[model samples]
Target: MALKFKMNRKGWLAVFAGLLLFAACESDPVLTGDEVSYAGDIRPLIDQNCTFSGCHGAGSVQFELLTYNQVKLKAAAIRREVWELQNMPKDRTMSLEKREKFKDWVDAGAPNN
Candidate 1:
């Protein structure tokens, strides 16, 4: 009797696992933009605006915003500068779209994309 009960429970567990997998297979897709690549999007924003005067350029700056790794190192402070302080570009040239995109990129685990 005990053996039979265990077998029945195992069968139900297997069925539940199959149903979970099938449900996952039917989910909607995740849409991302072509320019959403971190290196392509956010990096360019920093390079064009912040890094011009060797600030975060070919050589590392007080704030390293070149590569994802460099950017991550100073990400919090940079985010503060651009998002919180709004003291970036020193020229008020960074656009709203670029700022929102960068914020999304940073919020999304800062993926290399």
Candidate 2:
């Protein structure tokens, strides 16, 4: 016996759109060497922008970014919020350079160096 499945126009379009998005996302150039740094680049940026009182700091309701491990653990979420969604830093606007750094870091597998 054989089974057959059919998708409607909308379903096909949705699948195509998802594939396109995935391709676009995967097309980002990978960084190496000094392109992105965790201690020198990312930590300072996070400390200044994210880990403030009542935010992602210690004793806060939200996820704490007080250490490298915490930051590394939440790198994906940080990238999404900061780069894709552009909703991070709350009321403050993150600079393009800063946003790019975040994107590059996460895209580089969020190394802890």
Q: Which candidate number would show the highest lDDT if scored against the true structure?
A: 2
lDDT of 1 by residue, 1-113 (tens): 35544458889999999999999988844665534567778878877887665577766546555567988777667767787777876887887787777667677667776
Q: Each model's C-alpha lDDT?
A: 0.73, 0.90
Candidate 2 clashes between residue pairs 3 or more apart in a chain or in different chains: none
**Best-matching candidate per TM-score:** 1
TM-score of each: 0.71, 0.69
lDDT of 1: 0.73
| Model 2 C-alpha lDDT per residue in residues 15-85, reported as the tens digit of each score | 99999999999998676565789998999999999888989988879789989899989999999999999
User: Relative to the unseen true structure, what is the Cα RMSD of model 1?
Assistant: 4.8
RMSD of each: 4.8, 11.2
